[model samples]
Target chain A: MKKLPEWHRIRIIDNPVIRQALVIAGIIYLFWSMSSLDIDWVRVGKGFPRAANILAHMFPPDFSRWQLLLRGTIESVQMALAASFFGMILAIPVGICGATNLAPKPIYLAARAVIILSRTFHEIIIAIFFVKIFGFGPVAGVLTLTVASTSFISKMLAEDIENMPSGQLEAVRATGAGFFQFLNYCISPQALPRYLGVSIYRLDANIRHSTVVGIVGAGGIGQVLAASFSRYDYDFSMAILLTIMSLVFLGEFFSNWVRSQLR
Target chain B: MSIILKITDLTKTYPTGTKALEGVSFTVDKPQVVAIIGPSGAGKSTLIRCINRLVEASSGEVLLGNTDILSLNSRQLRRARRQMGMIFQEYNLVERLTVMENLLSGRLGYVGFWTSYRRKFSKKDFADAFELLERVGLSGYQNTRADALSGGERQRVGISRALMQQPDLLLVDEPTASLDPKTSRQIMRLIVELAHERGMPALVNIHDVGLAQAFCDRIIGLTAGKIVFDGSTRQITEQVLTDIYGEEDWSSTIRKIEEENEVGAE
Candidate 1:
């Protein structure tokens, strides 16, 4: 072969550190895969037929329970809206606490811990716990979604705060603006647009999650869907699924409108 | 005249082991434009930042009027800072905020939080902001968002904002560094003229030597974290420039002089 140029001849694999790290990662992955005991191809294959049958029965949806569907959907919308509003309101301070630039080390760490704890479990899992405490209603769904929204919104808001232009903050601080004044003049103005963007995006996600939290008896459309499914009324389940899809699409359209207004 | 600002043996060392300022000391008499000139990394930024306590001095006494600002608690420091107004090289106006809002931001130190939150400035503050905008030659641009303005216009707004504070002292760090020669001179002229109007002592850090000489009452030159030249503009000779910036070709003097003439015209 003809000689390659010096730049091309310089091999990336010549770096000993990267080569060693890749080797170690490969070895660990191989060992972990080999140590796994269960590989159930036959069970999954056997379950596919039942899934197909259920799916087939789910078609030609019956809209017999329109009143029940409407009530549950409205409840789910309320849960999502309440959770998003309260979550965003609470996130203002918590986000400031979590921002490395705004808070002291200990406060930032503690706020980060709060965010982590909130997001550690899925909203459904949180709904299960809240349902146990509050005994199954929109309250359980709202509270669960609230925690989930706060974690996501606060974390993202903190990141936006942290990433803001330091020059603007410095200029504001130099004017001798107090803590909240600095936030209002410097931090809030810059971060408001981005915060609104994130909150709207999170609201869309919360709407989807709120509809399903009812499956665990937290109270929403999912509860009705679960009941219909259990009773083998696949047609009603299909109707509920269509309604959920429509709600999601509506939520998306509303969020899009809000974003357009922000611009 | 009262000393508006007194810095005695100020020093700042960063966490990364960079000595930004070392035993720097200066004082500003009331109602004078004192310019600090130096090459990059010679503590010009650190010195100016130290004055407002934005970049805290590791060791120093920053006495503003009678209060030792370094000794003040956070609340007191904030109060003291209100009396001081700062402008930046990049104009640092909140991009999304209207020019009127940015101008009113200077009064944030005095107003209640809810006042700013509601964006309800006092009538006097609004009237003053409008007057300052007119004085700064930005009469019709109040509702314009800051990002929409040109560089010179933005700096004009910056000066208006600082003046809105009715500050006792003004600190400008490289206000003209990002601007063209003509715009730089315009900004320097505005800063100098405004400081004189308010009878507020001003400390300006600048990279351009001629602009400082043309606009400042006194020029303080720093090199390697120490003041090498502190004298009236007429007293600054080629020897002083050589001492502060080290040896460069003397032929550049004519270019600088021509640049100054062109800038002064604008």
Candidate 2:
């Protein structure tokens, strides 16, 4: 066997740059650990009785507010559906613009900037802003969810489009496929399944977010839950929490079923 | 025959300062199969791609018919590209699409976007596509997803898609590079037969010397981004092969079959 060349030999480095980075990271972790100092064993131990007392009062979920709860649940579902539908439709164009293959450099950069800005804030935060601008109710919640969903769906869709095989696109271009035709024949087919998957996932996420955005006076079950919490009605809060959990679980199940059907 | 495509002093230089094509020039008349053969990175692929403006030339003109293709706007370039069909080495079919859809993609240039979006091709285009599929021996596999097809089958689809365009010129870049020996021959024969049947000029970039010599009417040997030899198959002697490949050893590999044939005759 021939001897290996000196240039090909592996070597380990003991460098100051790596050591400095590790020291900085360790100091930051220490700072975080020091700031996490608000746990009181005695207070928690005493609070358990109060929690149990409240739980005892929450018997059978207080069906006196059944009509209100029913109305709120319906409104929440409607907000989620409207937001998801419009957001997904808008995401198609934004996602294409952000895709490196389809759009020119400037367009991709601009679309990516918009997606980043939209996703930076939580849906609840965006809902609060929209509530101030558009006034409270389902409209604000719908708008907030739409913006958040568009950001998430467009980002994922753009990534899916970017990762598609360039060979197919090149072949389509060689055939003299125009912009829309190239998208229709080459890009859409390759990215459709992934795009659908991301949209379904985003719909599930938006449903959960929509329920919470209503807590900030945007309308839905969240407003009622917040009102109950404010009145110190822990039992009512627990009931609402359970209902929200059930709704989220059902949404997840439905989303999974839809994804399977699409596949 | 009229000159269908002409290249004048074409040059392509990458951003990294590597020159892919260096003042290469050629004229391809109608109804001819011109094979470009060379070692890897010898500008054979670049030369073919430049013809269709897939890889834009840094300088010089590629005149297709009467128009200077390099000077055309995006719309005009697209219109010109519809007349030229390309086949790739990897058989770049949209894997998720059906083979029938892949063939129909060739007609996308002519069909309106809305119509193509609905996958509603005209009756004439559909009949032509089915005929081409039958010609390429993939009649029953039209509904098969491109991903599910074998390598040869995918390449067959690729060829059929090119034929679907009813193009004036066909450009094939290493069509048989990824196939086994037998399949390579079959692909070459199909390409030749299809080109002959259509009576269109076919510019094929091939790495295999035997395949090129057997299938092509004329062979243009490119080396270091320039055409070193341009002549008929009979003119591709050992000296010319040595000049193109830059090695005498390749001549031995090429001559071994002839030597065996002579021995068998004895």
Best by lDDT: 1
Error of 2 at B177 (Å): 1.1
Writing each residue's lDDT as its tens digit, candidate 1 over A146-220 gives 999898999999999999888898888877788888888888888998889889988998889988899998888
Expressed as tens digits, the lDDT of each residue in B29-85 for candidate 2 is 868899999889998888888877888889988988897899999988888898999
lDDT of the structure predicted as candidate 2: 0.88
Candidate 2 positional error at B152, Å: 0.7
Q: Candidate 2, residues A174-193: lDDT per residue as tens digits?
A: 88888989988998888888
Write the residue-wise lDDT of candidate 1 on B139-255 in tens digits: 999999999999999999888888888888888999999999998988899898888877788999999888887889898999978889888776777788888889876447535
Best-fitting candidate, measured by TM-score? 2
The TM-score obtained for chain B by all candidates, in the order given, is 0.94, 0.95
